[model samples]
Target: MRFIIDVLLTGLAVFLAALVLPDSAVSVAGFGWAIVAGLIISFVNATIGTILRFFTFPLNLLTLGLISFIITVLMVQLTSYFMGSKFDVANFWWAAVFALVVALIQMLLDSLFKSKNRD
Candidate 1:
């Protein structure tokens, strides 16, 4: 139940971020597609992402952990690949921007939920 809710919320963040970006940068077929994109992103981030990051730790150290941003960008591209035409990213930079926006939106949503829980 919790995992499903988190996935849905991540999907909401993805949808919102897509809207915030230019259509040429990031495009989503619909909210339903966004949800599937979210799942793909989450799964990819958790699995392949983790392994890649571990292997890239040396490079990440040199960049002061900023290499993770590249990892995130790649993750977005991988998600797009899984989503096929349902979700599309224009290129590397656009995917980077999209990933950043999605992270920002998800952070905001998480804080909102945290505040509500505290209330």
Candidate 2:
């Protein structure tokens, strides 16, 4: 299903971010941790993230929606917490960069998958 694919894509994005960012790392357990982090992120994004975004709408508008990127950073940090020792982020700034990379990867993967399905 699309949901399952989205989770997998999210996991892949996280895994890739870990590889590219020195400020973040994944456990030796690897894929399992990545998948778990991805699931947590997706769940939090759907629930808490939505509410937070709604409440932050004014800030989001004032910043021309740049605040959404900060929200994404918070979401990633939340995911990192649930990951326990399985994943780590150096700090808030690092988390922001890491989340941005993951978001970019997810967007790219989604577009690719959608195109493949279309064809």
Candidate 3:
């Protein structure tokens, strides 16, 4: 189904993002682990992430939406903590970098899929 494909594609994007970063910054054990991490990230973003974002809406507006980026970084750290060694981030900065990369790749993947779906 579409949901399954989205998860798989998001996992692929996470794996690609991990490869794009330095090992010291972000690293994944393998594709399987990347899938696991990606699913967790998506779930976390959907649930806890939504609540946090809603609460931070005012701050996000004050900062021109910079707070959303912070929320994303925290989500990355939470994902790393849940994943243990399989998915790791060196520190806050690296997690931010990883989050940015993952966001970019996910955006790209979504665009591609949407375009193809329309075609």
Least well predicted 10-residue stretch by lDDT in candidate 1 = 110-119
lDDT of 3 by residue, 1-119 (tens): 78888889889999999999999889999999999999998889889889999999999999998988888789889999988899998899999888888888989988878744542
Judged by lDDT against the true structure, how good is candidate 2? 0.79
lDDT per residue, candidate 2, 6-48, as tens digits? 7788888988888877633433148767878888887888898
* Candidate number achieving the greatest TM-score relative to the actual structure: 1
RMSD for each of the candidates: 2.1, 2.4, 1.9
Could you arrange the candidates by TM-score from highest to lowest? 1, 3, 2
Ranking by lDDT: 1, 3, 2
Estimate the TM-score for candidate 1: 0.92
lDDT of each candidate versus the true structure: 0.90, 0.79, 0.89
* Native-to-model Cα distance after best TM-score fit, residue 65 in candidate 3, in Å: 1.2
Model 3 per-residue lDDT at 113: 80
